[model samples]
Target: MSSDRLALITTDPAVLSGQAVIAGTRVPVSVVLDCLAAGMSPEEIVAEYLTLTSEGVQAAAVRGAAGP
Candidate 1:
């Protein structure tokens, strides 16, 4: 699916210290983007970061790509 979907997943100040991490983890959205950029497949991402889902990774890609 399109990555823009992740826009709905955010870190509000009251959440995640406003660091723009995933909804429930300390892992920043950029970390997910970096892993994809470094050639890590969605399955590998899920394997490496147990907390991440393939769909979440894809959504993060969409969100990261949406930035200015």
Candidate 2:
């Protein structure tokens, strides 16, 4: 995949006041990461947040694992 496709992180002033979020949603990347860390499955997350996908959840996990 291109880096852009793999990069789930994004920011836009018109979106969620520019918070870093998964591609197309107001859901902060950290919120997804926290849910995953709490042992919530991707399906569960999707069920709870329709804007999220399994890929998004996984990407959040990968990014979270890669600390700054």
Candidate 3:
């Protein structure tokens, strides 16, 4: 419900070489976007990646960052 998309994901040098990922998980933002781009639904993505949530996928699509 917030406009600040950055809050949905994080980037840390210790984590995936600072690649953007979901706030509390290692799932990369790019992965989520890739799923969507591949014609996968948010629900499907969430099912495939248990660490992901519908909200996170939405944020990833919007700000190129996965959900918390």
Model 1 residue pairs with clashes: 3-62
Compose the digit string of candidate 2's lDDT tens values, residues 1-68. Answer: 33544497778999888877888777888898788878888899999999988877776777676653
Find the candidate with the highest TM-score and give its number: 3
Question: Of models 2 and 3, which has the larger TM-score?
Answer: 3
Tens digits of lDDT, candidate 1, 1-68: 46445754677786567767766666778888899899988899889998877767877887877783
What is the lDDT of every predicted structure here? 0.75, 0.79, 0.83
Total clashes, candidate 1?
1
Clashes of 2: 0
Better of 2 and 3 by lDDT: 3
CA deviation > 4 Å runs, candidate 2? 1-5
List TM-score per model, in order.
Answer: 0.76, 0.78, 0.85
Q: TM-score of model 1 relative to the true fold?
A: 0.76
Cα miss at 40, model 1 (Å)? 0.7
Looking at model 2, the pairs that clash are: none
